[model samples]
Target chain A: MRVLIMAKEGEKSEAATPPTPEAMAEYQKFNEELVKAGVVLEAGRLYPSSQSKRVQFNGKKRTVIDGPFTETKELVAGYWLWQVRSIDEALEWLKRAPYDGGTFEVREVIEFEGM
Target chain B: MHRAIEAIWRIESARLIAGLARVVGDIGTAEELAQDALVAALEQWPTEGVPERAGAWLMGTAKHRAFDLIRRRKTLDHKHEEIGRSVERAQESVDLDAAIDEEVGDDLLGLIFMACHPVLSKDARVALTLRVLGGLTTEEIARAFLVPVSTISQRIVRAKRTLAEAHVRFEVPGGAERIARLSSVLEVIYLIFNEGYSATAGHDWIRPALCEEALRLGRILAELAPAEPEIHGVVALMEIQASRLVARVGPSGEPVLLLDQDRARWDRLLIRRGLKALERAERLGGALGPYALQAAIAACHARATTASETDWPRIVALYDAVAQLAPSPIVELNRAVAVGMAFGPAAGLELVDALVAEPSLKSYHLLPAVRGDLLRKLGRSEEAGDEFERAASLTENVRERELLERRAAECAAQGTAG
Candidate 1:
């Protein structure tokens, strides 16, 4: 199954740049491993929530709010698409991922057709 | 035909969806494929006569479509050339039925884990679990929870996204993870059964189908982890509670309180099954887990032939065990009831008074309702009537409200007669 792993937004120091050289190297190394194992179908870092806007539709007119939003309970920092034998396998791979300062969010992508 | 298909799907959809998820590697896709297969079944079954082994037919059809999708995706992206080649090579030798049969358990468990993942908030987890495992739709879940359908939908979408983003494993967690995850799983099942057993809203007192589904899932969990005492406790509790389903409502689906229920109408078979499960839980040993202790209390009531025959002391002792194992104001409240029955109404009244200041029980209608019952027993009819009225107003369930109101009226009538 394809699982998404997100780096938490709490690692503010590394939010803009890799906080430490070692952390960056570790991140790159893990990415390399994922790519080689064919588990990493796609992976990328997300822009910090600071620059984001949540567009809310109250009727037809859309209202946009600039971050920092009230709730930072969970914010996506980065993600990886992993192909694995089962969700357990996906978790095994997640345990190996680089999480220098933040939590990882893992989820299965829903596939739909005739959309 | 639609209702029949829906009924069948409700029973079989989780397995179908889980199987599809395993093969397609994405739940969203798997659900779509499953739906596609369902649509096909709807069109074909009425004309062809529903096939024997209908579940297998759905699985086969879903699997075929899933394989086709995988093949198409692999081939469309030359990037997956190796996968494409492997799919082509495997097609000739692969037996789909064997594949489907082998992975169903993991898939179902995976789906359950996914629904119960801790990443989502508690409300979200319960909503999603009921929707997915209980085969309830968004509207049904919302109606059950007394929430807007949009809110439920958002919760589900966010929950799924959270699990996906958190990289929460679809398969059941093991060791420490399982232990941690177990609490959430147990909580979800509890909420599901609670809604079924005593619905929070709507006209009915019990949604038996929901109760049965949750009980089945609990039993499956017990089988999956035989050594988990709490799982058996939960199963036992569910089984015992389910045994009373037949007696819980009148012909018109009105509420029937435990003290007023017809003992003769209660299913002896279910009580037996429940007692057996409780025994299994006890044999696992240690202090009685919260669920087992609750089941023990239920067993006490089940064993009694009539209200007067109830072993109030044993039930009170079981409640004390439950309180020690998992201390909650609710447990304390229940313990108070047992105390009232075992000793005198005044003793229970004192305990209930202490809980009035408890923040947790402040909004819990049952606290007032129990208090009212104790008051009535103590000859404080006026106060008891007021308490019942408050409880009736607080409760959202129509049947529960009506029952409370009736109790309040009875209290008033008794006071007038006196």
Candidate 2:
């Protein structure tokens, strides 16, 4: 099964402060582990909600909205696309991520015909 | 003439296609070119006489056809150039005198990885692996699983298309990727072996042909990935289990329990091979993985000259290790059996009863069957008969159902006699 792991935002506000070199190195090591395990098909950090855009279609009327949208806890800092044997296996790998304080939510990727 | 061509195809098709796939970089095209080579063989071999190096003849023909196809698709200059180099390299080494070379092993390994790629669904992987690597026809695969031929054909077609569309590499993956991919390949092989060892719904108790194919694949895998202890472990497990194939069924194809099987009928050669494989696995191991542990359990049984003399405690310990590595209700159930034999019937009964509420084991026939055996030993004949009846009703295999019903009848007779 393939799963998408979303690294949820914490109280520290990733948008306000830049990641330390040490934190970046730690993340790099973790990413390497994921790649080595052949689980992470793709993984990347978002440039904070400040650089995001959302386009909503309300009955064919396009409403454009820009981010730095107020819900900090709901924001996703980064995500990973992983192919693992089971949710438990995915969780086991995720448990070893180097981050000190953050939550990760795993959701199965829906595969369809021709995908 | 057709039979002779089929015999040649069965021996050469996997390597022929693998070599072609390596050259052309597309499994679908590789298969088509290989089929074309087979057609060429049918046309010429009848009159021209079959070549002494028939595998090389097929490979050479397939490679040349691949070269032609590459030339025909000259619209993509870069693809033509890239594939042209590989095709030319293949042509350089195309010596009919050296029919089966070392490179064929690597090519076959690459083909096995490709067929069992995780990009394909489980059913698709099984179908494609059996078709390409196992040298089985769509009809044969269909008949083996009792699925429609059209379904099998469609699965193979779609699997090839998926591999092409997904741009799955033709070469075997390296490092951890290889390990991840190897599990899927091993799983497909084991599934095939298990199906053959115990047919789920068929009238026959066992389909020896599927078992033979799986064993062949496992042996080849052991050769290709000698460093991987789990590969050796799986090979050992299959080899040891296969030794019992001859004794698993009676003259009339009735199911034979393991303890009741005629030990004299077991294949001693296979048992020896199995033990050698187990040793190889142990030599390379950090700790015995699930397969190796199971193989050790099988080895314990094989070492015993008689059923009563079997080392139940050692088997129980191996099962304990297996349960630790790969815990499943099925493993727990098997461990329970070992525990029962090693300790007493009540001990096994306690373990089996604890699993009665397990949702997964509720419909599994073995749970109730094991329960029935324990109950019968404990002199609870009426409950044992009911458990046996439940097991008989749950099982889909005709022969197994008959065995269970017979056990149920025995319980009833014993209860009445008492």
- The chain B TM-scores of all candidates, as shown, are 0.80, 0.90
Question: lDDT tens string, model 2, A37-111?
Answer: 335556777877778899999997999899777877778888888755457657656766788776789999763
Name the lDDT value of residue B206 in candidate 2.
25
TM-score of each: 0.65, 0.72
lDDT of 1 by residue, B1-418 (tens): 5666665676568788877665555556667888899999999999997676677889888878877877788868879765575456446424757765656666787887778877778898888787766667888777766779999989988877787678565566788888778878988898788877775222432254456557767876676567889888888898889778768777666777898899988868669878988999989988777778888899999999999999999888888777777899999999999899899999999999999999877779999999999999989999999999999999887888998999999999999999
CA deviation > 4 Å runs, candidate 2? A1-115, B77-102, B200-206, B416-418
lDDT to native, each model: 0.76, 0.82
Model 1 chain B: lowest-lDDT 10 consecutive positions: B200-209
**iRMS of every model, one decimal?**
19.2, 19.7
Once fitted onto the true fold, the runs of candidate 1 whose alpha carbons sit more than 4 angstroms away are A1-115, B1-11, B40-57, B71-93, B136-155, B200-206, B250-254, B363-365, B375-418
Q: DockQ, in order, for the candidates?
A: 0.01, 0.01
Question: Ten consecutive residues with minimal summed lDDT in candidate 2 chain B?
Answer: B199-208
